[model samples]
Structure formats: C-alpha cells, structure tokens
Target chain A: MTLQSSPRAFDPSGTEEFAHWLDGVRAWAGTAAPDMSGWRSGAALDLLALPVARGEGGAGAGFLATCRAFETAGEGAVLSGNNVLGGFLFAMSAHLWACQEPLLAFGTDEQRAAYLPDMMAGKVCGAFGATEDGAGSDVMSMRTRAVRTDTEGWCLNGVKTFVTNAPTADLFLVLARTSEHDSYGSLSAFLVPRSSPGLSVGSATEIVGPAGARTAVVRLADVTVGEQACLGGEGAGFAVLMHAMRHERAFILAPAVGLMAGMLRRTVEHARRRSQFGRPIATYDAVRERLVDAALHLAAAQDVLRATAGSADLDELDQARAALTKLHVSREFNALSNRLADVYGGYAMMPDTGIPQLIHDALASRFYSGTDDMQTKIIAEGLGL
Target chain B: MTVDDGVLTVIREAVHKAAPAFDGDDETQLITQQVLDSLAVLKVASRLENQLGVPIRDAELLPRNFASISAMRAFLATKGC
Candidate 1:
C-alpha cells in the first residue's frame, strides 16, 4: 500500500497559476544540479525575485508566495538527496531573505535601478555581511568600521564571518560602524561590490549540513564606495537589519516544514514496508505514535509560519510574532527530526537514508536567523515582560 | 504639535510600563539617557498603538520619536491620535 503525502494547501491566493509555479519549482529541484552553475542554468534566481515588485523586474509574488517557493524547494531538496542540495538551497534562500528583501524594501531609486534587475535575473548574486567573530546576536558590538574619507565616499575596514553565498556573490550588503558612540544608531549598511579594492573572500567554511552553502569569511581593508552606496541612509543599519530580520525570522522555517513533511512521508513509507517482529512496523502503536506526532508538529509549524507570513505589515506586534514563530518552529523541527529518526533506528545514521542530513539541518536551523534565546527575549519584550 | 494633558498622561504611562526602571521626568531623554533600549522602545510603541488606537509606521519608529514622553506626545499628535 502506498502512503501518499498531500501537497501544500496554504497557497494564499489558491490560484491555479500559483500551483503551477510551485510545480515548476518542484520540477526544477528534481533535476537541477546541486551547485551554482545548476542554479543559474535553471533560472532559479528568478524564483528568488518573487517578492520584488513586478515593475522592478520581479514576478511580485508577495512574501507568502516566496515562502511557499522556499517550502517547495525544501521538499524537493530532501527528495533529491538533501546532503548535496540542502546547503546550496539554504544559501539561495538566505540571499532572498537577508540580502535581496532588504534592498527591495529600503534601497533608493538609483540603487534599485542599479542592482535589482541583474540580481533578479540571476546575472548577479548578493550576500549579507553582518556577523563578525565578536558579534552574533549582539550585532551592535561589531567592530567593522566605515570611516568617512576625503574622497566621494566612505572607507570600510573589517571582517564578516559565516556569510552565506560569500564565495560566489558579486555584491555584499555590509553593516559597518559609522559612529564613534556605541549605540544602535552607530551602524550603517553599505552595498559594496566584490571587485572593490582591498576586499577579499576567504574559503568556504565546512558545516554539518547543507554541504554546498559556501559560507565564508569576507575581509575589507580600506575598501571605499560612493556615498550613494549607503543603504537606508547612514546610522539606520539597526532599523534596516531589524526590518529584514522580521520577515526572515517569520518565514525562515517554511523550508524546515517542507523538510519535515518530506522526512515524515519517507518514514511512514519505510514503516509500512519494513516489517519487525513478523509484522509491518506500521502496525505497531509505538511507530504509529511517532508518525502521528511528527505530522502534528509539521501541521503546527506550517500554521505558525503561514499566520506570520500572511501579514503584509512588519509592525511591532508582527515583529514579536515573527520571533515567536521562529522559536516554536525551529524547536519543533528539531524535536520532530529526532523522533522520526527513531523509526529508522541504526539506518538513521546512514548518509543514503537522508535522515541524518535532515537531522543536521534541523539542528542548524536553531542557530540561524537568531538563536532560540534571542527569539525568547524578543517575544518577552513584545509581551512587555 | 502641542499635546494635551490627557495625551501626555497616556504617553507617560506607556513609557513607564515599557521601562519600569525609568523614573525620569517627561523632558528627560529616554533613548539618549539609555532609559529605554531598542526592545523597550518597541514595547512602548506597542503600548502606544493599543492605547492611542493609531498604528505606528516604520518611519516613525526612529529613536527621535520616542526620545521622551514629550516627544512621544508630539509624535502621537502628528498621528492624529
């Protein structure tokens, strides 16, 4: 007997066009090579442009549609051997959520005209340079400096680590300290081209899951750009980052939901086929309970992500809800992955089963887009606690 | 934007609730004085949104708008709250 997993139902508009677009995404994922060249050849970067306005060289698919695209890509990645495509997909999504969205939301007319077209068309790739060795959740502590120069712009000097897509990106949205005072208002965001003098990208950092993500360290030594490169104005980096993170933290788990859904479907099929104690394991209450729990978890996570992404505004309340959503979804994804792994027992450790890769991806989700503790703090502040 | 006493009272209450540790006067600098951090400002914004029935836009969430109770009152007056 075949146990079939249903397609995702929260299409926002519930239109045939949207479903077709998702099917196309799934088809690409099924066949695309798990590398940068494959992404470009498949026109996958155009899919990341979904949230930009139509006039801005994008499909204008809105945030929920973009989340759905990520979800579909996630399921496709899992079904196509997550160990190879997981990290690569994550890097692309990070570009969408962290780099592209902020530029779309806050870029000046000139900046948008200069970059969005090629970025959306997949001709150019972008990366976010925010995290530093000394700074992670406490972003204000970053030591990257953007000193005002006598030339037409500012001189930047510092290093950013754990930057996704750093190795292959053509442009970087970097956050630097522009003020002497240690305040939120001290930082600023800049659009620095990778070809800038005194800029360098180190080798990719090997991570547990998402093997091809190409996370690397970026270094800037006396790199300079025109004043026009400053995004959202000087001293607005904190606000810019917060605005981008509100969207990211809310829907970052969409892919995880897809991954969990795919993993659960696979586990159920295995349970039905793999017999133990002279009967199919699917007949056992313990195995069925694990499957049921994973389904419940996936359902709750999907609902939370949908509710948070459904909103068009990024107000204070929405910011709080985004944090709560990230917190709950990441934790649930991790727990559900472990429970699903139990059904596989020793085979769960095998790389070919893809369970280990999913488990590792689940573990990594907790740390990205701010950790669980940071989310709790944001939620608490939202409650005025 | 001259604010009425009622509006000032509501703003002050929201500010106090957001930063209970702050015991300064209405003219004191909330952000510069570090009485309200970024998260506390968000809390104050949320409270003001509920109390005043006006949605605060992202542009108005700047530190200048929430520097003090007097500042918040002026900002709210502009919002027609």
Candidate 2:
C-alpha cells in the first residue's frame, strides 16, 4: 500500500473490510438506508464505531476505511433518488468527528458515559452549533453570549445558524462568548439538550442538495444549562473547536470520492451508448481525456484523504493537512461534476436525468465543512506566507 | 537522474506503513493525493531525519518539497537526506 509520488489512470478502493462494508452501504443507500425518516437500524453507528473507538492513530486508518465505504454509499444513493445519503452521512461524520470526537478527547468520564452511549447506540442524533449569521468565516466575531449564573449553571443568549442535524438532533454543542474579552479565547461551548427551556430550533430550512440534510437556526434566549453540560471548561471552546474542525475539515467529503467514481462510470457508459455524429462520444479523444482526468482526481483525492485521516496528531500540522484535503478534494469534486455534466451534454441539463441535481449537489460540497477560501487561509498559514 | 532505489524504498515504506491506501509510483502527485498527508508527513520526515541525522523543518515544509517521490528525493538530496 505504499503511496505513489505520481499516478496514472487506475482503479482505487479500500481494504477488504471497507470495500465489503461499502458494498453493503451502497445497496442500503439505494434501498433501505437512504430513508429520510429516522430508521433506527443503527447503520451509522455500525459504520463508524470501529474507527472512532480506535482513537487517532487507529481512528485515522479506521476512518479512512469508513470514509471509503461512505463514499460508495453516498455516490450510489446520490446517483439515484434517495440522496439523503448526503445529509445522513455528512451529519453522521460531523457528529462523530466534530462533536463526539472532541468530547471524547476533552470530556470528563461522567460526560462521556452520559451522552456517548446513547449516541453510539443510535438512540440519539447530535448537531454542532457554531456558525452564526454574522460569523461564518470569522467565528470569533459571533454575538452569542454565555453568562455564568452560578458555579454550576450558565445562561446563554444568541443564535446559531446552518446547524446540520438540527432538525432531528437531540443535543447540540453550542459555542458562545463567556466574557467581555473579544478574543477568540472568550468563546466557550455548551452541551445543550432539546428539553432545555429557552432553547428553540427554528423551522428546518430546505437547502440545495437533499431534503433529509436540513439546516436551521437555534436561538437561545437566556437558555440555562447545568455546569455538567459544558464540553471541556470555560475558555476552552476555541481549542475544542479547532480540534473538532481539524477532524471535520479533513474527512467531511471522503464519501464524495465514491460520488465521483460513480459519476465517471455512468458518464462513460452514457458516452458509449449515446452516440452523435455517427459515433459514440467515448471515441473522441477530448471526452476520453475528461474521463481519465476524473479517474486521476479520484485517485489523488483518496491518497490525500487517507493521509489526512491516518495522521497521528491533531495539531497545527494536522490542521493544515486537513484543510488542504478539504480544499483540494472539494474543488476536484466540483471539477469532476462539471466535466461529467458536459460529457453528458443537453440531456445533462434535463432534471429527470438527475445530472442537474448532481451538479447542484456538487456545488454545495464547497461549503460543507468550510469553504475552499477558508482552507486556503489555513494552507497559506502553514507555508508561513 | 533518477533517485536511488534505496531512498525511494525507505520513503515508500514510511508512507505505506502509515497509510495503506496509497500505491502511487515516483511520478505520482503525492501532495494532490495527500499520500504524504500531515500525519504521514511527520512519520516519513522523522524517518528520513533519523536515517540521515538532519532536521527537516521550517522553510522545508513547502509542498514542492513533497509533491512526489522524485521531488522529495531531490529535496532530500539538497539536505543530504
């Protein structure tokens, strides 16, 4: 499994276990698993539990396997009608890597025992609340405030936007400013439950890709929670957030690799079957090159994705690596999608063909974890530029 | 000139042990594929540094330094890696 310094067109896949699981997931996504409704099959848990339990070193390898599986499942489903594979898989990754992983890394034993088991068992769905209307890129500029009401209680006020899994999340890891200090360090995170008073989830806002992957605003009008609800301690939220973001940014789109592979395969089939000018489009060197590029991108993305996923540390170096993967893989996926659409021609524009839907969905990949622009910032910092 | 097979083997082994998914040749784009991703990069870098007793840090973190095995070999040769 030695990584290549350079590559040519070739088939790429995961370990036997990952490939086997991916096959099952693809079948599930095209059939039962893509259900928009809560299907307590514990599929998400079953898919992810192994890697996450393995910790960072083991988690890296394990997560790469899981992501490879998710890529195929997401592609199979996204190619067909039930792309809830988009929302479900993305939300699952966010919950596991962003919210749960951080908690597992920094949380108390009581905290882990109280929240994690239920989540692992598929008894609960989780959401991460960080982005705000005024604070997308500049997260530290958020207006959300948390005031210490007592040693064991705190009141939080403000709104969180674009919260994934919010429509069904039983719990939220909310970030809020806890001091007059405007520095990012003043920010803190709270583990707020659905039952907490003054905590309200706005109506689910439909987004570009799939219906199941809903986003909404969470407003806390002086919401109060016990000290036990705090993830890590006060002023530790930024560190916690960075840790979570490092994981999320790197692996958020690992499944898109599968999506690209499926698209390329389908496009090739279409090019051969749907001929023009008395010949198949596949005969054209230009069209062939496009397919080859798609294959090349898929291989390249998997390599980087595996590298980021398999890293041992979660420091600045890991952060840069994850940012690079998120940035490169997303842009590459978008390119592959556009190429796929062009290769399909006018029929690609037709809604029934699902190419248009895929195009729209592919565009949304740019914003999932963070935008490519944000990733560039991290990469630039790493270069000391 | 091509990089010596021994250097290539060590780099490949370091990366392979760290991540089992990558199987690119010397001409493969390592950065694009992320075969030398952050975590694996440290492992490979440390392995090289230990093998040669030279620190690879600071200005040496450039992507071009690790874009491919050939690039890495050339870069390492500059530092007598």
**CAPRI quality band, candidate 2:** incorrect
List each candidate's DockQ score. Answer: 0.37, 0.02
Q: Pairs clashing in candidate 2?
A: A4-B24, A5-B28, A6-B27, A6-B28, A6-B29, A7-B28, A71-A255, A304-B33, A304-B34
Query: lDDT of model 2 at residue A252?
Result: 76
Per-model TM values vs. the true structure:
0.91, 0.75
Query: Alpha-carbon interface RMSD of model 1?
Result: 2.3
lDDT of 2 by residue, A174-248 (tens): 988887655444667889998889989999877866434667899999899988887778766766777788778
The per-residue C-alpha lDDT of model 2 at residue B2 equals: 73
Candidate 1: residue pairs that collide? A87-A210
Report lDDT (Cα) of residue A9, candidate 1.
23
- RMSD (Cα, Å) for all candidates, in order, is 4.5, 13.1
- lDDT, residue A378, candidate 1: 85
Please identify model 1 stretches exceeding 4 Å from their true place.
Answer: A1-12, A41-45, A313-317, B21-27, B57-60
Q: Candidate 1's residue-wise lDDT over B1-81, tens digit each?
A: 544668788888888887788789889988767787666777888788767778775445676788788888878878786
Evaluated with DockQ, which candidate comes out highest? 1
